[model samples]
Target chain A: MEKFGTLTAIAAAYPKVNVDTDLIIRVERCAGTPREALGPWAFEMVRYRPDGSEDPGFVFNREPWREAKILVAGENFGTGSSREMAVWALARMGLRCVIAPSFGEIFFGNCLQNGLLAIRLPADEVRRLMALASAPASATFTVDLARQTINGTTRFEISPRPKRMLLEGLDELGLTLAMEPEIAAFQAMDRPRRPWIYL
Target chain B: MGRSLFEKLWDLHVIAELGDGMQLLHVDRHILNELSGSRAQLDNAKRSLKPRHPQLTLGVADHVVPTEPGRAGDKTPWAKNVMQIFRDESRRDGILLLDVNDPDQGIEHVIGPESGFTLPGTLLVCGDSHTCTNGALGALAWGIGSSEVCHVLATQTIVQPKPRSMRARFEGALPPGVTAKDLMLALIGKYGTTGALGHAVEYAGAAIRELEIEGRMTLCNLSIEFGAKIGMVAPDEKTYAYLKGRRHAPQGALWDQALAHWRTLPSDPDARFDREVALDCSGLVPQVTWGTSPEDVIGVDGRIPDLKPEALAYMGLSPGQPLAGTRIDRVFIGSCTNSRLSDLRAAAAIARGRRVAAHVEAWVVPGSMRVKREAEAEGLHEVFRAAGFQWREPGCSMCVGANGDLVGPGERCVSTSNRNFVGRQGPGARTHLASPATAAACAVAGEITDARTL
Candidate 1:
């Protein structure tokens, strides 16, 4: 995972509510594709035409937004499927941050795991961000993880653990393994109480 | 202040309180399927790490496995390869693999409870979102991402922030023909998909209590559809009976001990929830989704609301159009959500003595091989076949559309699966989510029709 600190880049606005994991990367794309290769297929359904040409009508295919590294989206973004490839696709497509009013619980976790900064803002704040990102001249926004602010103005709230994970790119598995003594002790006490659980 | 079921389950699983509202949770059961499991295993292998507790994990080859009869020869080389990898990895990691030919093989959520691997008061995690289906067994189960799968595999634990508790109490008994599927769809329709976000929702009251084990599973299956990662029903006599002699359930003295613990798993009286919503199901009718999102649903006889133009345009449906009577090109009656024996029986009852309409292509894919075998022994397969509905082997056939079972582009399908998101069935494929019986009715009528009318 890449460490996420502060990033300043072009942000695109896709304000469609309930943009699920299927829309982020269809199930078909996940069949055999490697994680790094999923970039081109991100939002493939709406991002391309039948002939495999770019759908110019899509915001990410237009002017400066074509180079966007951030996305300001509508409510309930990444709303379906526990497929972590959705987060991988967005990250592999160069999106470093996503600002939305709300997100699916699993998707939010997947984003943190992959170092993609997913920030939840008020609906009005998200709409304002979308408006600002819609105009090419005002599309550039800065997301600073260290200070937990967007554009050095709007502060965002993130839990301490995920915040630290994002800033340091800490491997969660390693962190948990470090607490092996605690885990073993808990199991020692729990095993006799619930003997059926241990196979 | 009594504790909610979620609080009790959380407390039981916590290994350590890693400050900041997060806790390292010890996973009691971790179920895995080919699509996600193979990747996680490969990632672990690449890191040269071994699973901390393979005995606690259960593997099933479901996703991407062909559901056609004689599927061993029918699978694409690519899919066959994926299954082989899953098989090889499960063996290498010492995890119990329910291979493609295993009699118990099925969708993880379906098989978990059926085989007794899922039990009351246990915290289970799977790589699929519909894992909440097992929550019906009075367990705290939810979906996890592939990375979390690797985490659980390597550490037998997951780090999670505590979630709030919410309760949806169905106050009245459901009328006939209105199944648990309808109860869930009606709830999602009434409250948008995000209604229960960041909360663990418990189904309570008359309707939920009256529902049988399979029906409860169907209700809990769609918890993910409504943005709740966890959904559960308190274990009762029905739950106990359902697990009494299943393959992996506790036995002998263990059974007695397990029962005593399970009896205490329900929420204590006067327990407070962070949120509460109540619905009167006495007047509720069958539900059918009309738009892309699961929340874009209406009662079978109700008109489509003028909402979400993109969803309307994608589904090729107009505002104020009655959901019923809309023509359908296909009917799919299987998925983790509703592929159990009861679901099959419900659909079979409707298919009895009636042929599928010539214009519609319909199929019945059971949830598990056990379900398939049980259905066949009961002659349900013959009933479906005689009615011109294809009786297929068990797997997630058309639900995810990854195993070469898909609705054609621009074709409208009535499915028993959970999600109806854009391109969920296939690119340009429009899906109307419904109960299995309702899907059978759509097949026989060549259009969306209420199961009760038949």
Candidate 2:
């Protein structure tokens, strides 16, 4: 069940950290709007306007991230309310992997449930990538998770389990079902031999 | 080989190790509330799994319960059915169920730790993100989704991958008006929103040592904001004494043994971390978030920063405006983050017969019936009601904005709730996050004001 996917694209620019749930997706949008509406509403607090138009100098909208597939952000990237819509918005925006220093608990759960990859690189290493990703052209870096290295020149390795989950796209449920036989066998053990309570 | 608390807890609960960083973990505590119950029931029907460890799990009617206990059914028709089913299922399984009328019933996370279910060196899980709040007791804890809730209910174990570790050292004393909420908000500002991604943050240092157990719980509650699984304050006498005499705590000789081991759970002087973040608590003022993000804060003496054109248009706040002078239409003081007695004391010290501004609507909700009872016993409720603030029952209330109590569209509020994200308080409602004292002063002045105002 373990699977891994390489970064198809890199979207990098640091926004002010601690982005919360409601700001990622409006309740109005979650009520009836098409799921894809999440992309347009992706950073509502940062992207919202009475008349929608691009703010050329905006960090996410500026330069390269116009079609970012992977988003690299600052620390505590998804802290705030427990709105699942935030994950929906980021996923809809085609952000498959978020390599950051940290993430909000609810947002992290939401992402894992939806099969998004949230990788934690050290702050120093993430800072290096952020610096490289922000540069106009030469600042570009690659996240070759398959190789277990992040950048071409200054490669970094990921720990085993996260790498496995990311590569295989297996969630906790999938991981558990893989052990059905063992669980059943444990359950089937005779009541008399280990009779702690009634079944 | 050395194992972190993660590896140790993971090893203790491992029912079967499926290769490659996954294992079936025996869930020690299965915490449930209104929102999780509905989704879990639906998923269970689809999956056809019976209850696994119902005795190990506990349910409370909070998320959808109204602040007024009698009108619980009217809170939401959706919640009515959900709460009914939660009651029915728990009764069916003989599980511990604390519905709205129960003494322990409150926001599931807040009551879990305070009422004695949460303990040291254990695993506690809840469907609410703030469940990480229990990690303050030195346990390994985190939040899960509804489907995960269903899975855990059907099978006490949840499968999870390990996360990296980060250590946050908080040094120094908090000046008189500062509370744990202010310290957490200050950490968010310095670290930005995404600063602690995928790392288990261990909070230690002078300020952390000085904090009361409940205050430390407040500190750990907002870890989700910084993108961490949980935050921990190493077990100390404060933690032991708080847990003592609670219904779930160990007794007599067992207590001596547990305390002896729990005392050693703190990190050694030489323990290394993938990352380290530190804060000096004294300099932080009563903090509040002016923008959507929790870290989007300015001190009580500060002004909201000028925003980019889009941010300016999204939130109606104009750039470069002084936060202290910005009028707030609503003021709320309650949530797991700031509904404890200390929070009320802070807010009431600022309110106390000071008429709330003509333009502001204020609410002071105690975290639990227990908290409300304690506050009322101490006359804190009088201080609140005297200020024209609505005194409400113990429930999540406006924290999740689940019930109808919410700020009107386009109206601005200074709230004691954790998040200030858009609509976090209500649809199209603008929110500014502040500590209880700040919220109280804002209500009195109809603008963001210092809690220490003369």
lDDT by candidate, in order shown: 0.92, 0.73
Off by over 4 Å in 1: B72-75
lDDT of 2 by residue, B1-454 (tens): 3445544444545677656765666667778876655556555756666676676687877776778535443535555666777777667656788777777777777788877777776677887778888888988888876657877887767776666788788888889988888899999888966677667888888999889988888889888776676788887888888889876666776667667766666666666678889999868788988777777787988866775454455467777777788777999898888898888888899888799998888998888778888888999989888889989877887777776677887988899888776677776777888888889989999887888763
Off by over 4 Å in 2: A1-19, A23-109, A115-171, A177-199, B1-24, B68-75, B307-309
lDDT, candidate 1, A1-199, per-residue tens:
7899889999999999999998999886676788889999999999999999999999988899888999999999999899999999998899999999999999999998888999999999999999999988899999999898999999999989889998999989889879989989999999999999988
Q: Give the Å shift of residue A70 in candidate 1.
A: 0.6
lDDT at position A48, candidate 1: 97
Error in Å for residue B136 of model 1: 0.1
**Residue clash pairs of candidate 1:** none
> Could you tell me the C-alpha RMSD of candidate 2 in Å?
5.8
i-RMS for every candidate (Å) is: 0.9, 5.1
- Model 1 interface CAPRI class: high
Cα lDDT tens digits for candidate 2, A60-127: 68767766666778766676655465777788876776777766656766676666777677788777
Top-TM-score structure, candidate number: 1
Residue lDDT tens for model 1, B1-454: 9998888998999999988999999999999998888889999999998999998999998888888876743546667777788889999999999987888998888999999999999999999999999999999999999999999999999999999999999998899999999999999988889999999999999989899999999999999988999999999999999999998899999999999999998999989999999889999989999999999988999998888888999999999988888999999999999999999999999999999999999999999999999999999999999999888888888989888898989999999999898889989999999999999999999999988987
